[model samples]
Target: MKNNFSHFLASLIAVPVGLIFWVLSSNIFDIHLFLDVLVGIGGFGASYLPTQQIFHKKHLDKYKLTNSEYKYIKEQLNQADEQIKRLRSSYMNIRTIKDAKMIYEINRIIKTIISSVEEEPRKFYRGQQFFHSNLESAVNTIEKYLYLYKMPGKSKQERMQLHETRLSLLELKRTLQSNLSHMNASSYDDLDVERELIKRNADRSKKRQALLTNKLDKEKINLKKDQAKEYVYRGDKNGE
Candidate 1:
């Protein structure tokens, strides 16, 4: 092979090059210098060969993922994308000051999740675990926000908005939990279930978004209808 030939050539050249340097130094100054040069060359060769072999092995191994593993990884990536989309949509719709703070915390959590999913496979499990921890923290923050918003004295509109936002937060919590479960269950050979889980989670998120959007639209329409009815009632009373 070309690689073997190159290694052979390198070894051949290294000995002669080392010897040439030794001779030149000896001729100019001292024999001890030549002996020290030879010792140095020996030490270099001893360290270099094993290091080169290890590096070569690692490099070759990096490209050898099983097809199923690759598919599973791709599925996880898709799940991450879906999560980001949902987070961005939810963040844009956030209205109240309390909800805005929750959005900020969710944004941080989503960023961590995205980073973990993008990390090299060699580092994935650890990175994903850290991401899951952040997600839990985000969930706790949302729970606290929901609790604070549930107190007395809120306008009807505020209460409705809080209820919808709380629903979104619960959906997010479910998605995170599903993702963490998949990450924990994943392995080299049996990733089929993990892939399915991710796909299912993404599907659930899409459904949740659709439901939230529809509900928000309905609420807006109902509010307009109620205002129109109130105006009509007042006009009829005045005419009477």
Candidate 2:
């Protein structure tokens, strides 16, 4: 919508272009109506968003996706982002510690998927697929359960249903967690490698510093030994 010169140009040209084609065909053949319609469609197609969507959009480059994949994945990512936003709205209304923790984990997973795609799209795409599969159902299930829990005056059956729903949501959360566990494990391995690198550098630095200190101490001791011999020789000469 922002820089839609094509649409504006189409709006300006379509009528004149259609009319010109109509007049030319009217003189040239009896198929003026068909020509007019064809030109009109061509103008509209040029101005359509789908045409623009397939073009090499620079912003989508960050995700490292092809034009088609960019469109598809961007749509899915937007849906998940919206769901995460809605879930955040319920933070203050959360009742139990367990529910809060569940929400935190879900947000963590969603945010990680979003970040990982920008940095490492290939590695994070599996997480993206998992998100697409679960996001809508998980949102509905959690929100519906929370809504029911908040509403007053539940019958015995409704109470029973609430408990069942809670169990189901718990199971769903656990399922999502299980799928994300492998991703978390890979991250932990990366952290371990980084930790070892830092430790090795620190060890090297300490050893270098200790070696310099030892060398300086030996030089000082040798200087003192040489000075003592000179003093004894000068004292014997004075006695003579």
Which number leads on TM-score? 2
Per-prediction CA RMSD (Å): 29.1, 10.2
lDDT of each: 0.60, 0.68
The lDDT of model 2 is: 0.68
TM-score for candidate 2: 0.59
In model 1, the clashing pairs are none
User: Clashes in each model (backbone N, CA, C under 3 Å)?
Assistant: 0, 0
Summarize candidate 1's per-residue lDDT along 7-113 as a digit string, tens digits.
55556556665565666666765669658687557755765576555544553356354545545655665655655565555454445786676567556656645
Task: Provide the lDDT at 173 for model 1.
Answer: 51
lDDT for model 1, on a 0 to 1 scale? 0.60
Task: List residue ranges in candidate 1 displaced over 4 A.
Answer: 1-60, 122-240
